[model samples]
Target: MRDNAILVVVARFLIPLVMLFGLYVQFHGEYSPGGGFQAGVLFASAWILFVFIYGLDTGLRVIPQRVIYALASLGVLLYALVGLLGVALGGRFLDFDPLLDAPKAAQQTGIILVEFGVGVTVAAVVMLIFLLFARRRADTVAAGLDPDAADDVREEQQ
Candidate 1:
């Protein structure tokens, strides 16, 4: 993580802008090339940038890992429930015709729900993966077992 004031200032300025763009991608996905996956990545990157500027501990304190896990699970449940709703409404699985009065509107609503579910899960999982790797790397560095350290030692010996 950087201790530089300029870096922190820049990150603070850009985080909101990037997150807003991610939201745009999320909502405008149906009519544009961006979608849940892209939006999720974008959102995850915003948090990750914060982690980079600050530290993992700070980031986790801001949004605990338990919450992230819950969000992931909730996303999956949301997707499943939307599909189940169609079935419960006397239609096939994921058949959202019964969700609203207009078929087009119902389908769009279903799609949006599904996309949201995917975005949530994807964002959480990405953050989890990043946290896992960052923790491990931090530990390795702490223990002085990092591969980069080994390479450095070898170079010094040579």
Candidate 2:
């Protein structure tokens, strides 16, 4: 990890704010330029910044790999479950009319729920990607080799 103490402090402060902004974007998407997918990426990027500055092991300690995987799976399940609810109510897949007794409200609520799920899945997957790359880089550096050496090795092999 690059140990610029000032940068670390700044990142620590910025990360939560960015995460909070992501939530705002996720929830206010109906009336905003941002949406669940954008929010998720933003949220994931915050963590990625932390990982890059603090190191992969520290990142993992903050958010366990197993938990991230589980959350990603759960997000998919949640989205599917909402669709199933619509089916059970005699509507087509993801038809939100059955989400509530009031059809209009149901549609709105259903959209929100689906968006939430999407955000969760997107965030988790992005973070997972970062984790994998960061871990590989960390390992390579620890092995007394340049982390970028993998690219050269691959090129040579080819």
Candidate 3:
């Protein structure tokens, strides 16, 4: 993978652009068509592309599995805390009216926070799933198994 100079160069150029787009989508979501989910997927896709080009071990080294797990937990906690804040402010769960002096400003703040939380959670989960599958494939190959051979054998059996 590292031997391909063109791919390496293109990836170096595109990965940052992709992440930048993800940020744009995240911040502009409330005003536009996009939101947390789209942004999160974009972010994950960028990382996945990096892994494909650089190799799984390198990807893991860049963003360890433990950090990904923590991000997932942190995102959820952030989401919950926002909702809880509404309750603490004497409103229903997720109510943004009581969040600030101005109801409109409060609503906007709440939406942004919630959306950010969703984005974080989605990105982490996607990365986690990809990492697990990639690790499994690595292990299969390490064990001297042709990963695709199982599928071919299954097809023959059927």
The superposed Cα distance between candidate 1 and the true structure at residue 85, in angstroms, equals 0.7
Between candidates 1 and 3, name the one with more favorable TM-score: 3
Off by over 4 Å in 2: 141-158
Q: What is the lDDT of residue 118 in candidate 3?
A: 94
> What TM-score does each of the candidates earn?
0.89, 0.85, 0.90
Order candidates by TM-score, high to low.
3, 1, 2
**Which residue runs of candidate 1 sit more than 4 Å off their true CA positions?**
147-158
lDDT of 3 by residue, 38-128 (tens): 9999999999999999998898899999999998999899899999999999999999988999999999999999999999999999999
Task: Rate residue 132 of model 3 by lDDT.
Answer: 87
| Weakest 10 consecutive residues of candidate 1 by summed lDDT | 148-157
Best-fitting candidate, scored by lDDT: 3
Report the lDDT tens digits of candidate 1 across residue range 1-59: 47699998999999999999999999999999888888888999999999999999899
User: lDDT at 86 for candidate 1?
Assistant: 94
lDDT for each residue of candidate 2 in 9-124, tens digit (9 for 90 to 100): 89989999999999999999988788779999998999898887887778889889999999899989999999999999899899999768998899889989899999999999
Give Cα-based local distance difference scores for all models. Answer: 0.91, 0.88, 0.92
